[model samples]
Target chain A: MFVDFLYELRERGVKVGPQEALTLSQALGKGLHETTLDGFYRVARALCVHREEDLDAFDRAFAHHFRGVPDDALKIAEEVLQWLLDPRSRRELTDEEREILEKLDLEEVRKRLRERLAEQNERHDRGNRWVGTGGTSPHGRGGTHPSGIRVGEGETGGRGAMAISARRRFRDLRSDVTLDTRQIEVALRRLRAYVREGAQDELDLPGTIDATARSAGELEIKLRAPRRSNLRVLLLLDVGGSMDPHSEVCERLFSAAKRATHFKELRTLYFHNCVYGRVYENGSLTRGPRIVDLLRECDRSWKLIVVGDALMAPWELTASNSPWSWTEEDRASGIAWLVALTGHFERSIWLNPEPEAAWYGTAEVIRQVFPMFRLTLDGLTAGIQHLLRGGERSR
Target chain B: MDFARFRGTDAYLTSPELESAVNCALALERPLLVRGEPGTGKTQLAEALARALGLSLIHWPVKSTTKAQDGLYVYDTVQRLYDSRFGDGDVRDIRRYIKLGPLGEAFAARDRRVVLIDEVDKADLEFPNDLLHELDRMRFRVAETGDEVVARERPVVIITSNAEKELPDAFLRRCVFHYIEFPDRELMARIVRVHHPDLGNQLLDQTLGAFYQLRDVQGLRKRPSTSELIDWIAVLRRAGVESVELDDSLPFLGALLKREQDLLAFAEAMHRGRRPRA
Candidate 1:
């Protein structure tokens, strides 16, 4: 069981070696209470897994090998495997139909959704009227929801979800990802703004020396408040599965926003793909505040730079289910939230990690809402330049 | 060990699961890898555990530039070279230049101790991987002295990570994993009581309510942590403020909210009659 579990974990990219397996075997020989699954889990985890990322894989492998074989096991395994293999589900509706549904009365659909939620008791999937995945339900995700709410769709294939009927917080799991500082420094240097914020007592060495000389060797001192930069930046970063690949660049932008001495006030928040509903303060995403509340609270004077690939499924932007999770809630579409965000922070620009040439299809749709810019040096410069040129001055 | 007395003494409360996990790690003689958010008491766990277990604490704080070798030992080759040039005493004596670092000292200690490797995630990716052998073997050889330094008694190692970087799976396999999540309202109240027993219930309730309200604010740049709550209460006490009125809590918000955005949001909310207009 132990060897098989280790092999399975290794196959799943866990990097388990013979030495670790050997240690596990020895540790097991010393007698770990295996009556409870938790005991075995702790022991195996200590001996077989090393990385935090690998814990998921280790848990999967352990569950497969040790847990009692049940009918649901195969079903769950297949589902998890499918989710891993291809996040975006196959859409049945044509472009025209989806377009028409996109134009449907979202408010009416939400009213019907509340009625269905109050009536429905049991869990339903791929069904009409109730919330579930892979069906022509007006409430669930991964299915057709013409004038309906999307409950729990994972990977949206450009389908504009009407509204997210459910709400749940998914953590920005890619916090550990480190980006090269070189590129970040270069990118941030272009957007540098320096202004004296406040002064502190500092010796004016040049003036002191000149005064001392003029006073015929008499001790002289000059005190002046130091000039500090006064730049306030509000950076919103997209993090999760879609943003995972672009983590390095996102991290670079995030750290640069924080580290840059010019920025007297630097505030960063994490969201997944689009800022729907809320954004997290920390990478862990344990705590979140509503977007509406934030927009109202934040000072409009702060420069807002939103960083994301802008490559999510169309429905994630236009439709109901949030890109973050599939919990039932009467919330607006992700794009609606984005528009509101831009409206609040007039000096806002979206930094796209994906290449400019790739900005076709769904990316183009997002570009329509947010003035998109490439995350590279030239792109950031252009974006900053646009901001400096008072592009948002009219607003 | 009298954990009940220890808990009362340190004012550190633990869930039953966490207590068991710690006890289990101790029983298995495996290092406990405690991961949590900043100010979630991951580092404090080591101190509490050490005190509870009646063991001396050996702290080894890791920095981004810290090397794995620095934790093991420091060989003063420069000093030895200086001595050779000056024809000083004991230039050839390797012991003169050998100094055991925290980890090395933990292994060298005759009595069992608690080794707290704080913020392991700050170090280079290879640092944790490199320690696999030393941690597993609990012994290392000093090439300069041609002497083998072994553990007289294996110290209970407590490693912490803020999840800044992912540790190597190999290193993780040798240790027990535990994550300290943010305390709930009840737990937070208990924690506050432990820290500030004299604080009025009404004030504590008001402070916690405000703390949660601020935390729930959408688009918060940074959320106030548990430590910040304690700090806020301390500031309130210093100011001789006995009550926590909704509008009055605005000024004391500096102790809770760290980020400019958070501070601004709270101020805006206060200005807008304690609820965001949007």
Candidate 2:
């Protein structure tokens, strides 16, 4: 039966081989059950991949392999043999072959093919998404129905429990947890109302013409796209010892902030324990030309998201370190530089995952200088909501 | 979300990116090249693919000294001798025990498995050039059986590299590439929750913050990975350090940072920056 299945897949131009058949049989034994098509799908996936372009051929092989079975093949076959056996597809068969099946009173053969053909037609009309249906499924959003759909769930009566448990868990799987802003889809909708510059409703051309007749053969009008932040973002991450705990969260925030806004200038710099406003060279954080270059290049419109817990030891921000010890400036200028940067960014906000209560006693000096932009940490939910809302306000 | 569906005790064991890469592999039929820093689960991709797909896991941790044959087949002299001395049995049975090396076994697998050619960068400059055909053809030759094993289509293949230097253009052309960056804070928190279920929320948050601060420093040769921080927290928890104190933090530094030079660099960083308690 397996041999016949392979032969059938080959006849349909699937390029099935010995190793692929092994995978098919394995997925089948693992339980191809009621959802026969879905079972073959898992098998097809495991055994058939060779190149990015060969996927379509693999799917065709799977469909043809399970299209139909002859009565003789099922007589002495194993239970899984049911899967190996399938209805012979008249789609790939010759006219002569169809004539034979017709003689056997199989009227549904052509009807099934016609139905598949009609479904194929429907797909092209519906944006051509299914591979065999002659469409694309980028992001895995489109595909033809498979033989089995629940094999991954397991092979028993626990389907309800299995589904319930999976649904109960995995409900909120955030790929990035950095900035806690709304996803692009959701955030875009909120900002759409503010997108006032979308090329003015086809220029009241007729209105201008109508006005020309009344006025001195001329028209005076004004138009605008409204203020938009082609957006510029500067990301400053606190790396090294102090940020160890919030590293992952910071990364997620960084990822989200990168994706969320359309910044005109985006310069992400990594600073060690604290941002002395110095750059690193030869593994040593030093005040260098690049540091000045970054500062000199910046404009006030850029939105800055500093992702750190901001729970510093207080002295790092308040203490007076030597100016020569850094570069270009003394400890006084370093503190002034930070204060200057904070004042420069008009559309900036800081996102600290640490709670407000935690920061209350630790780094009070930081807030004393730049209290406006701190990520007001009320709690996870409220904090994220505020970040998203603030991002919306900025754009 | 259902980590139970994940493959192992580590690597793909609890990672979302790994899951996406594998699913992408199955659906697209594309060989994936995953890159990241060391211990960020580059090699674990193949291991997870093997477990998730339910097949033999064939691994070849490519060393700088690896030869192409190192991954294909190896003769089990002792087993062959045993078979020769005992039942004088079928040579075919002995051939089965002479098991295929990870990459070779993946291709020669009786059932389709996920083959991980780990640390491809460690392999010689000629490695990818040599693999171009087998990877493209999805087939290999088995000497014991005198058979050519073609893709009856059982294995999902994932290759990983650290990109210590650079790979040839030929390699980049043959596979789909993805960079597995370090996790962000939220994902890191989830990971901490998953791995160190015993850690308190407040302590966990502080430890995560500490790690990020460490990463900010430009001195360390290697930054502490998400897993390492979790390990550090576990050590601290075990050592009875109730808070993120500097003395407690210093002892656990070994788990967080690698390279003695990097550690020295980290200590120097501690000189003027904020201390753990501060």
Candidate 3:
């Protein structure tokens, strides 16, 4: 039975094996489950399911395996069936009670009713107590209690156990359905490029041993700086306007980049529809550093990432005297500035939140100046690989 | 030696599921891998279990630079080099310079202990994999002295992770896993009462209402967790604020929302009388 249950879990896509099964059996042997079905559920889940997303699958498997018997009342069913079969208990029934008892199919009684009958020993023929055909007791047939488990019913046996697994409390935790910040963070980890550059603190054991052996009877020590990822990231985010619909994914990406420890330095700046003259340091766009100064400050070593939909009026990217340009000194068009920025950075990529099927107009124009990839797990991974590769000096 | 089951210490409260997970790990002698949101008392679970079981706690806090060998032992080659050059004592004995780490100490101890590998995910991805052999066998070898140190009694191991990184499958498969859910209102109230015994029900209700509402606000970079809620209550009581209204602005918003963006988002959300768009 346990092996069948294990196969059921495996069939439902939970990654369980013989080792997990052995652990479950060992836990059961120790009497950890206390011989209760609910206890077994907890123990089996803890032993078999290691990931939170796999919980729903585990629940489905459990419900299918156990059916409707209450975890703690599996033993009581047999004992209660015997008590219900006893003719001595039925002998005390009144004529009206015997009529109600005759209506119940003795062989088709539900497990829950039997368990409840085991709990209530005294047969109270009337008044909401005991399993006798009567007034509002959940057990026994011909009772008028609302939503109570009706005895002598065969089809509703699975409802009790099904309700427990049907809750599916962990549905939100499933990673395949949503792109959370943690998943983005994991994708961002591929951007790490480790280069040993720091204070010489870590012991170079192999170097020390080699030096000592060469010196012959002389003690020598070697120290080298620990390897640290020297990757510097400059994230430019386009906020507000058409980007509002994609803000959730963009925020996840922004937060993931901000929290990522792989890079030696990470700087974030926000822009509106397009980048031309300046970019705001804060999301509200009150104050910002000039684009020219920022370009001069950041060298080619920094990998530049621009996140935007790139869907805007054509004039915004082409015309220098467009209404969106804030200052007279900002003479270059939006595309010109983007080209200059992309040209200055050794590695640069633009992430478009808009799906590939929707890309056209300004998005197509932007793709010409910079390599554009969708803002997805695969897209981010591909963009990171592009940044890591040594072939491209500039787009 | 017999040990009592961990029911939870006076200051800590565990749900039935978490309590059972702890007991199952104890019975099977497998490491309990605990993952949860930050400030959900992941580290405190280990301390609570040790206290409840009447065992001494041995904490090995893992950092990004931490290696598996660092948990077992560290051969003090520099110290030996210095001693050979300047000290009168013989430096030929490598045992003098060999130092046992937290895991090594736990193995060599006379009594069973609760060993906590806190934030194991903070280290490299291979960190857990490196300790698989020692953890499975409860023994390690000190290569410097060529001596094998085995456990007198297997220590109860509890590993915690913030889900910063995904742990390897092999390491996860060998352990009992539990994800500590964020406490609901009732459990949160009980936990708060443990810290603030004198707090009134009205104040608790208003603060919790506002706190949960703030968490529900969209586009928050970081949500305020249980520890922040406790701190917010502490700040409220310190200022002698009697009645906090759920409709009104919170008294000590800084105590709950740590990030600047979150505070701004909360204010914008409250000002609009609706949840802010992401």
Query: Could you give the candidate ranking by lDDT, starting with the highest?
Result: 3, 1, 2
Q: In model 2 chain B, where is the ten-residue run with the lowest total lDDT? A: B1-10
Decreasing DockQ order of the candidates: 3, 1, 2
* Candidate 1 accuracy as lDDT: 0.67
Cα lDDT, all candidates: 0.67, 0.54, 0.78
Model 3's DockQ?
A: 0.32
Query: Where in model 1 is the C-alpha error above 4 Å?
Result: A1-395, B1-10, B84-88, B246-251, B269-278
Q: Better model by TM-score, 2 or 3?
A: 3
Listed for each candidate, the true contacts retained, as a fraction, are 0.14, 0.00, 0.61
Most accurate candidate by DockQ: 3
User: Every prediction's TM-score for the first chain?
Assistant: 0.46, 0.43, 0.62
Off by over 4 Å in 2: A1-395, B1-20, B75-99, B143-146, B245-249, B274-278
Q: State the lDDT of candidate 2 residue by residue for A1-111, as single tens digits.
A: 454555444444444443344434444444422134443344344344433234556567656665664334234235445434533322112222324443533344434
Model 3 steric clash pairs: none
In terms of TM-score, the best-performing candidate is: 3
Q: How many backbone clashes does candidate 1 have?
A: 29
Q: Which digits, one per residue and each the tens of the lDDT, describe model 1 over residues B111-180?
A: 9989999999787656888888998899999877778889998888899998775565557757777777
